[model samples]
Structure formats: structure tokens, C-alpha cells
Target: MTDPSRRRVVVGVDGSTESRTALRLAVDEARYRNCLLQIVRSVEMYEENPESEELDSAVAFVRDDLGFTEVSGLVTSGFPAMALLEQAADAELVVVGSRPRSAIASVVLGSVGSAVATHAPCPVIVARTSGERATPGARVVVGVDGSDVSERAVDFAFGEASHRGTGLVAVHCWQVDHPAAARWDAEAFATRRNEHLRWMSESLAGFQDKYPEVQVTTSLLEGRPAVLLTELSRGAGLVVVGSRGRGGLVGMLLGSVSQSLLHHAYCSIAVVRPVVPSS
Candidate 1:
């Protein structure tokens, strides 16, 4: 368990452009949240080095360029995902970069990002690019499916929107019977759309009330959830979603949409898992 009193943000560094971008964002987030910053370097078994220049440079960037007072750096040995999860056990958020350099790199990095997002105890931000900037009131989009898992994502989205003083777009996507069938039965399509809108409204009602200052908009669309959300992410500053939903398999940790966005989303993504109540 993480220390209860200390709040920290951890960033995994691997000397890639994505990792550097993740480090910068972690610094900005830590500064905004007024928390300590931790830079974690993951090394394979035979390549572990105490005097790694990349690690040193990352720490230097925080201390010199950013002027973060409480910065800690660690060199952990193992797979990057497992090392990060253990090192950031007490962190408020774990930040990682997700751009792949090659096909094999894509498979490797994708697995790392997906594993950490699915199993991490806290929130995980997968930074895909170096130039994503959010103004004071930019839009933050979240996917909702009216499940307990999605409710947690809604809560995270609301809190983020409230903190940034931005608007929240809650998207609920449903499939139509068929395009040809819908063309024939306009009334049936209308009824189905209305039902989805109603469910979306009810799912977001509490969040709207809690964060009254946040401008809330609901989108009910007919398409694949992943494609729609990825399209919406283009105009959004951040995309948030639950690890799984109603359609997820009983034994799977991540749903298709969440997993898909982790790799394809242009903007930063947050994969929020359902909160497990402490025993």
C-alpha cells in the first residue's frame, strides 16, 4: 500500500520521445496538483545500470528546467509494466508514453501500457504525443455505458472537468438494428434513440448535480463505440473510459473500446478501473 499522507505522481521513463513527453506532462500535473514527482526508469536484467544518463537527465529536467522541489528518481529491474506498478504502488497517478517506433515495438509498448492501465491501483495516463495542450476550459470527453465500472469513469471525468473548469461530453453509443432496417422503420429508430438518450441522461444526472460548474453535454450516436470515441477524441483534450463494460467478458480485464483507444487515441487517455472497496 502507498503511504496515506504523501501524494505523488510517477512517470515511467525509457529514453523515448513518448517517455519524454510523459515526463513533461507528469511534471505539469504534479505542479498543478501540488504533489511530489517521481521518475521511474525500468531496466532489463542484464542491462541494469546505476549510472544511467537518461535517468539522470530526466531527474535533471525536473530539478533544473521545471524546478520541482520534491523529486525522486528510481531505477527498477524487470519488465517495465511490473516494475512501474510496484514502484508506483503509492502514487496518485502513473504516467506513460505510448507511441510505437516499430511493429515489434508497438506490440511491446502496447502490452506495457495496457497492462499498467488495466491493473494499476491508481489512474494511468497514456500520453501519445508531445504537443497536447489544454487551456483552462478545454473539453474532456468520457464514455459512459450505464454500468458500475463506467460510473467510476464518469466520476473521474467530472472531477477532471471541474478542476480544469471545462466542459464534459458524455458519449453513449448504441448499435442500430441495421441501416436498411432503420431506413424502413423511422419510428422504431426514434424510439431506440430516445431510450439511449434517457439512459445517458440518468447516468450523468448525479455528476451534473455534483459538479454544477461543469458544462455537461450528452451524445447519443449509432456506431461502433471505439470508432466514435476515437473520432470524438480528436477534438477533445482528454479521453476517459472504464477498463471494462457490460459487453466485456467475465474473465477479461479490459474491454475492446478501452484497449483500442489506448493505442489509437490521438489525445491523452485515461483508463479507469472500477474501485475495489477495501476490506
Candidate 2:
């Protein structure tokens, strides 16, 4: 059981390099937010000593390395996704690692990071195993698609930007009909792209009005959404996206674009979902 009054951040660790990276990042975030850090390791019910001594060693390393004062480690027996989702119910944020599936897996079989990001009750951070830059301040980037999810993403991005006192960049992307035209009509596309940029600006106007202190910029590109988003993520400290888009099943697993971005995006990605109304 979790205490509702205490702020908590849950992170899943499985000993993978990506998972280790996520654990380190989670520790830093937990320390910065002054929140309790809950480390969860899930294993099959049949496995003996579920989270073996090795897992304990890793948790100890995180505690010693990050100097985190408030930390708890738990070993649970269940499916990874289910265990994480249950743990996330009381968390302010949940962090997980991205694992690429083999070629035999279905195209829709997104990494566990994507699945948890799509279904967790709280905000999910999908951390990749990339080297960190010694940047002073974090950058917040939000993906916009004119849907409720996108709106939530915008809200999360702005809120984070305000919290971190960093810049917020709103990005939208579209596919080009002709490959040649994509290069030839760069200037013409700029004008059309401005329209989309304007739309994003208008969509996020309320957030701007609410958080007047946050600096924000918008970009619209004519290309594959995932590709463009991943490219923009290179310089961002945090990238935000909705669990699903306009075409996805609401309140379900992550949609295509969100799923794709989780694995390939350069920065730490936050997946936001709409608030479910109580019955």
C-alpha cells in the first residue's frame, strides 16, 4: 500500500544497461523533486528469490551514487507491465527503460517502456541509454496533433517548463506527398508550416496565459512525425507526447507515433495521458 500524502517516484529496474540508465536518471529526478524513490523489480512467480542479491546491489549503488536519503526497494512477482502499473497508482512519476524487440516480434509490439508509458496512471518517463550532456537547464518539447492527448502533452510540457524555468518548444510534423517536392517547396512549405505552428500556438495559448513566466517556441515540419520528433529531441532535456493520438483508442495502449518515439527519441521522454473522469 502507498501513502497518498507522500510524493513518490517509481522506477523499474531489470539490470539491463538501459534500465541502469533509467535508474540513475530517476534517482537524480527524485532527489531534485525531494520525493520518495521507490525501486521496483518484477520477476516471474516461479523465480526463486525474485529480485536476487544482484538487484539489491544495484539499488545500493543508486543510493550510494546519488546520495538519495529516502529510498525503498521492492521485489514483486507478476508480469512486468502489470506490476509497474500497480506500483504507479500512487506515484507522481514512473520511469522505465526502452528495450528494442527482436525482428520476429510484431511491429506493434512496442518496448515495455512504451507499454508502461501508455497505461500508467501517473506520468511515465521513458529513459534511453544515451550519454548525458552537462546542460545547465532542461528543455521541454511537446508534440502537437490537435487532439485531447496533444493538449495534455502541451499542458505537461508547459508545466514542466515552468517548474524547471526552461524553454518550451512545441513541434508538429506532417508527411510530404512527393519526395522531390519536399526539398523544392521548402520556402512554400514554410508558409504552410506557419499555419500549423499558429495552430499549435493557439492550442497552447491557455497554458501560456496560465504560466506567463515560461518561454515557448513552436515549429512545424513536413516530414515523418517520428523522424522529426526524434531529431528535435537531440537538444531537448525532456520530450513529451500523448499516449495515443487522434486515431488511437482512448485510455488504451500507446499509439503508433508515441510508441515509435519512445525507443528512438534522444532525450528523456515523458508520456502523458488524459485524466479519467471518476464514475
Candidate 3:
């Protein structure tokens, strides 16, 4: 049973290498936040020793090997994505792993990672590699597009940066199709570029004030948002983006840029949805 008194970090465990990676990250994060790590696995309940064996060993690994005492695990019955979502309702964060997909899906988030990232109640971190760990004082990057969802992402990024004692890179990317346009419509292009820079500044100003210790930097680039962020992810400890963005149509849950980063980011990616208030 989940102890409601203790804050929890939820993770999906499938006894795969990727799941083990997710478990490691969850343990690290839960320890950092002083929260409980709840590892949940989905099974039909009739499976024999290997399933039980894996779960038992995973628990022991967390307790005896990892030395995290506040660890508990359970086997629930349902599909992987749905079961994980049900377990994550009260969790502070949901962590999941992504396997390398085929060439096409490689450019987008995998099926399970996509579903959970879009619908999880809280922020979701999609772990891409088994060994990419955020080092001390590493940088967290977030893309802002002047939307409500982007605002939430910025807030989450600031908090994460502060928690990790790292810096925040707030990136805003704008596109100019041709170099000739810059030479031909110089003033217009300059004005538009200035506008983008101002928007990035305004978006980060309040966060900077609130998280005074988190060193914040701004990246205003004239390129595709997804491409720029992908390049930026090479040096980032974590890359964050909104579930849906200014380019997405109404009611769309995930944006193209966010989806792209989930597949291509070098480090962990956090997909944050805007909180909806209750009635």
C-alpha cells in the first residue's frame, strides 16, 4: 500500500534494461527529494517465477544495494501505460524509459513514452539512455514559445535548476527562411528578432527573480525550435518543453517540437503539462 503521508516518485518496472535504467533514475531523484520510490510493474498475475524473481531482486537492489530504505514495489494488472498512469496520480513525478525505435518512430517518441508523457498527471521524465546521468551543477534547458504551456515549462525548469543547484538555459527560437530576406528586409527582420529576444526575457524574468540562485541564460536563435533545442541538448543535463505549444492546434496534447526532443535529446527530457484547477 502507498503511504499517503510520504511523498512518492513513481516508475514503471518491466524487468528490462530500460526499466532498470528508469528505476535507477527514480531512486536517485527520490533520494535527492527525500521522497519514497514506488516501483510498479504490470502483470497478469499468473506468471511464474521469473516475474516474481525479477520483482524481488529489484526490491532488494533498491533496498540493500542502492541503500534507499523508503522503497516499495507492487505488481498490478493492466496494460503497461494505463497501469502506470493509475499509479502516478499522486506521484511527484513519473519516470519512464525509452528504447531506440525504428527510423520513423526514432524521430518521434515511442508508443509507451508518448502516451504517458501526454497524460501523466504530473511532469514526466523520459529517460533515453541507460547511462546518461546528470552531474552536479549541470545545466537544464527549456524551450519557451510565449504560450501558457510554455510558461508552465519555464516554471518547472526553474524549480528543477534550483533543486539541482544548476543553471537554467531558457531558449526561444525563431525562423527566417532565407538569408536574402535578412539583407532585403533588414529592418523588418531586426525588429522581429528583437521581439523574440524580448519575449524570451519577459518569460524568464519572473522565474529569475523567484529562483535567485539559479543562474539563468537566454538563447534567442534564428532557426527551427526543434533543431536548435536538439543541438543544445548535447550539453544539457535535462531538456524541458511544454506538452503542447503555440504551433499546436487547440486541444492537441503534444507539440511537434516536444515530441521531436523526446526522441532525439541526448539527456533526459521532461514533458510538463499545464495544471488545470479544479472547480
Residue-by-residue lDDT tens digits, candidate 2, 109-193: 2446656887888789887654544275868888899888788888888877877789998888776566678578888667766
Q: TM-scores for all candidates?
A: 0.85, 0.79, 0.87
Q: Compared with the true structure, what per-residue lDDT tens digits does model 3 show for residues 53-91?
A: 777788888989889878887777667788888977888
Q: What tens digits encode model 1's per-residue C-alpha lDDT throughout 207-264?
A: 8899899999899888899999988887577899988888665335788898888867
Tell me how many clashing residue pairs each candidate has.
0, 0, 0
Local distance difference test values of all predictions, in order: 0.81, 0.77, 0.81
Runs of candidate 1 exceeding 4 Å displacement: 1-4, 46-51, 100-109, 130-138, 177-181, 247-251, 277-279
Over 4 Å off, model 2 = 1-4, 32-34, 45-52, 99-111, 131-138, 163-165, 174-194
As a TM-score, model 2 comes out at 0.79
Candidate 3 similarity to native, TM-score: 0.87
> Which should have the higher lDDT, number 1 or number 3?
3
As for candidate 1, its clashing pairs are none
Indicate the residue-level lDDT of 277 in model 2.
69
